[model samples]
Target: MQSQDVAPRPTPASDPVVDVEQAEAALVEHYPRLVRIAYLVLPPGLGRGRRVMTAHALAQRALPRGRAASPVIPAQANGRDGDPGYAFVRLRVLRAALEAGGKRRGLPKRSQLPPLLPQVWGLKLFPRSGGADELALDQQLSALSGPARAAYVLRGLEKLPDGDVRRILTEAGAADADAALRAADRVPARYELLSSPEFDACSLQARPTDLMRRRQHTKAALAAAVAIAVCGALVALPGDGWGPDGAAAPVYAQNPAAEAALDPGRLVRVTGTAWESAARTDFSAWPARGDLVDDDGLLRRALAVWARPGEKVRLSFTPGTQTGGPAGPPQLLYAGTVDNARVVILYDGLRIARYAEPKDGTAGAALDFARVDGASGAEAAAIVLDRADGNVRYLTAPWVKKAAERDLMKPGAGAMDLTVTDGITSPLASPATRAGACTSWNVLQLTDDTGTHVLSDLGELVPARLTTGRPAKEKDATGSQALHAWAPYACSLGAVRSQGVRSVNAWQFAEQELPDGSGTGDWACTRAETWRGDGSRTLAQFHTPGGAYGAVVAKAEGGPACGPRDPHVLAGVLWKSEGGHWYLLAAGSRDTASIRATGGISGSAQGHVLAVRAKEGAQAELEGTLEDGRSISGLR
Candidate 1:
C-alpha cells in the first residue's frame, strides 16, 4: 500500500452540446405547475415543504434517455442563467437525503435556497409600497445563490431574449463577479432559426426526393379529399382515382352489403365511426332521426331515449336478426335517464359516472347492462378508445336480460347547475347538463373580474387569517357533474378537468378594509376545501392545525408571515376594489404585519388589500367592491 496514485482523466473541453430534443422533451414531460416551480425557486424561508427533490425528479423524468445528459442549455442564456450543475447537484443532495433517512438523519430536504426572483419588469407580486424595500426583495431572494438568483429572475420574470441569455448563462462561471453582473444586463439573444422545428427544418439544406415529394403531394390531395368528405361528404374516394381537371367527383355510397344492412324506417341502430355516421344528421329535427345523431356526431341507437332528456325510448329490432345473441339481435332502446339537466346516466343515482369517447374513452368505467339484476334491451354499452392508438370499440353491456321502464326526473334542487358567464366567449354547452354528484372535486371557472372561480364542496367554509389561500379538491364524474348554487356573473370556463382527490383549487379575490373592524371595500371568494371524513367534524384536521384559519389575513403592504412554532391567531382587515387593488388594514389587535400573497391581481388589472393590526388573534368584517360597483356586503 506504498504509493500508487493514478492521474485523473482530463475532462472534455466542452460538455456535450446540451441535447435540445432531450431538454424539450423533459420540459414538456414534467410540465411543472407554477406553484411547484415556485416552491423550488423560492427560498425555504417561505412556508414551503421539503418537496424540491420531488420537483427535480419530475423535471428529470421529463427528458428522454441520454438527452438528460445534454439538456438544451436554455437558448436564452443572458443574466445569471442557471448553472447546468445546480439542478443535478440538487438532485444528488435530495437522493442522498432520502437514502439517509431524511429528517431523522437531521438532513435538510432542500437547502435554504435564495430567492431566484425573475428580473423581468412588472412581475412584482407585492405592490410597490414604500415600506417594502428592494432590500426586502433581496432578502427574499437570499435563499438563491448569486447565479441561481440571476437565472431565476431573468428566465422566470423578464423572460429575456433566451437564446442570447442561454449563451450568457453557459459562459458565466461561479468564479466571475463582473461577468456575472454583466451577464445579468445582457438581453436574451433571439435565435429565431432554432426557435421552432419548422424554421429549423427549413433552414437546413435537406431537400425532399422526387418520389418523396410526389408522395407528399398525394398525401396532401388525399388529406384534402378526406377533409372535404369527412367534414361534409364532398370528398372523393381515393379508390375512385383522379377526376378530369374540374369535373365534380361522384359520391361513394356505403358498400352494398353495408347499405343492405342499414334501413332508416326500421329504427336500426348503427354503431360505428364518423365514416359510418354519414348515414345520420346532426340535431336531427325528426324525433326518430334526431335521436340518432348527437352534437358530437357519435351514433346513438337509443337516441329516442336521450332525445327528450327525461323520456324513455322503446326500440325493437327487425324481425330477422343477424348478430346472434341470447337476447336476439340487439334492439336499440332509450333507457330511463338519471341526471335531470343534461342527459348522462348516473350509476345508482349517486356514485357518479359516465361514458364519453373523448373524455373517459378508455371504457374503464363503462356500465354493464348484461350484469344488471333486472335487465332490458341491451341495458348498456361500453365504448373503448385507446389513447395510444386512437382506435375505438363498442361492446354491449353484459347484464341486459329484459326491457324495463322507469320515470326519468331532474336532479334534486340543491344539486349545482353551470352556465357560461362572462369569461369564456363561446356559447357551446356540454351535452350532459347535470353535474354528477361526487364526494370531492374542484371547479375551476373564470370570475367576472378576470379572476378564477375556484370552488370546492368543503362541507362548509372554515376559518383562516389572510396571507395565502388553500387549494380546492374537485370530483371527477361525467357530464355537468356538479351544479353551482347561484347564478353569479356569467363567465365561460372551457371544459372542466379534475386535478385529483387531494389537488385543491386556490383562489385570490381583491378587496379593501377600514382601519376599524367594520367592512369597507369590495371582496369575494369562492375558494373551498372539504375533508373526506365526517361533515360534523371541524375542517381543521384537513390542514395544518394551529396555522392560519379560513379567510386568509395579510398586511396591507408587506405581509402576515407564518407564525412562530407557538400556535397563535393573526387577523387583518382585508379589502378589494374594481380599480384593480386589494388592501388589508389592522382593524383590531394582530401581531403579524407583513404577508406574501399569491393569486391576486396578476398579469391584469385588479385591486386588493390586507392589513393586520398590532395584536395577533382578532376578528374583523370582510368587504370589497365588484366590477359593477356593487358592494361585497358580508362574511361570517
Candidate 2:
C-alpha cells in the first residue's frame, strides 16, 4: 500500500526519452482526469508535502519535447477545474505498472472490485457531489500515498490515457521510470488499461478538435478582460470582480441576496450563502478535530504555550446554580484564581479591565460574561475552575482564532456550556443545568416509541413549524404529524374529504413511486393538491365517466407503460399562459440542493397543467432561486 511497494511497470521498446514522449502523448489525452485524482490522493497537510513535490516534478519531466519549451500549467491541473489530470495519471501509472509485471498485490481481485465499486452506492451519481466523487475515486487508491493519489486521479477521474502519471512520479523520485511504472501494478486491473499509451493516445487523438475549440474558447473567454453574459441563465458572475488577467473572478455576495448567484463555475466560496454552499460542496469529509474544552486543568498547560512574558492572561468560567448564588458568569472563579496567582489583571476573559469577583461568597461572580465579545486578537484565553478541595482545578488557554465561539455552536442549532466555579469549594461540574439558557434556535431532540423529531433550538415550535412544517389544510383537516427531514423535502400524508375532493383532489401519502412504475426508487411527496393555473375557479368533480374531468389534468403526453425500460419518471409541471400547455419547470428531489433545473423547455414536457383553481384572481409566488439569478415562481 505504501508508495515504495508499488508494482513495476513495463518499459517501452524505445529509449527513456522516446518512452517519455509516448507517455506524454498518452497523458495529453487523459491528463485532466489524472489531475483530479492527484488532488484527491494528496490531501492537504504536511503528510502530502513530499508527495506533492514528487508528482509536480514528474509532471514537469513528462512534458513533450516541444511543449516543454513553453511550459504552461495544464488546463485540467488548475485547482478550480478539479485537477482531473491527476486522476488520469493515477490510471496510467497503475496501467504501466501492470504491463511491467508489477505486483498484483493489494488490489482487490476482480470479484472484490465489483462489490466494492457498486454503481448504486459507490458511484455517488448525484450531480452535485464532485467532492464526494473525489473521495470515492481516491478511496480506491488507499494503498498509495500522496504521489499515488495524484497518479490515480490523473488516470481515473481525469481519465488520462497514458502512463505519464508513472513517468511523472518516477521522474520526480529520480528512479527508473519503467520500473516505477511497473511498481504501480499494486493497483487494480480496471485502472491498468487507463495508463497504456496506446489506449490513452487513442482516446486523446480521437477527441474531436471541436471539443478542444470549445475548451480553449471557454478558457480564453473566462480569462478575457470583460465579462460577457453568455446567456441570462448561464452567465458567469465574477465572484468579487473580473481578475486583472481574465482568470475566473472571485465573487462575493451575502445572504438572501447571494442565494441566486450559485453557478457551475463559482464552486468554492467563502462568504454568505456562498459560504454554506462552498462548505457543503468542498468538504466531502467531516472535520477530524476534537471538541473545544475550557477545563482549567488543561488551561494551565495551554497558558504555558499561550502566555507572553509581559502580556496579561485572563481566565473565564461560568458558575452553575449549585454554586449557591450567582457567581455572575462562571468565569469569576478563573478570574479570582488568576488574581490569587498574582498574574497581571490587564484584562478578564470577558476582556473587562480590573473587574473583581463578589466578596460575600455569593458563590458566583457578578461580572457580565459578554466582556470578551470580540477580543480574539490574543493568542489564547486562559481559564481556571475550582475543585472541591478549594485548589484551582487547572487552566486551559485555547488558541483564540480556532477557539472562536462559532466553533462551539452546533449545526442546525446552538448551545452554550458555562461551568460554575466558586473559587472557594470544589465547583460542582454538573451545576451546568439546562434552564433559561435554552433559546428558540436551540434544538430539542425528542425520541420516542413511534419516531424521533427535533424541536428547533428556538423554543418556539411555531417558528419551526412555520419554516419546516407544512401548512394545515383546515381546522377539520388532519394536521401534519411533524416529519423529520434531513433533506429539503419529505413525504407526508395529505387528504381532502370526499366533499373536498370534489373541488380539489388531495392525494394521501402513498408509498414511494418510481418515475417509471417499472421499478426504481420512490419520490417523497410533500405537497399533493389539485389546482388549476387559470388563477380562478375550482373543479366540482373528477370521475365523470370520460377519463375524469375537472380543473385537474394529466400529462399532455402519457408516459411509458409500467415496465423496467424507463430509467426515470417524468417530472411534473405547471400550466403556463399558453393553452393546453404544460412546461417543464423543475426537477423534484427530496434534497433541495440536488434538484436540477429542467427548464421551461426540455425533452417533451413544457409547463404545468392545473387540476383545479382555488378561486378567481388567486395567484401565488413561491420563493426559491435557481443556480442562476432566475427565481422559481408558483406560490406566494
Question: What's the TM-score of every candidate structure?
Answer: 0.23, 0.23
Off by over 4 Å in 2: 1-297, 303-516, 519-636
Clash statistics: count for each candidate: 110, 122
lDDT of 1 by residue, 369-486 (tens): 1111121111111211111111111112222111111101121222232332111111211111112111122222222221222222111011011112322222321122223211
lDDT of each candidate versus the true structure: 0.25, 0.25
Residue-wise lDDT of candidate 2 within 228-313, one digit each (tens)?
44454245555574446667555853443233122212211122233233322211111111121223333332222122211121
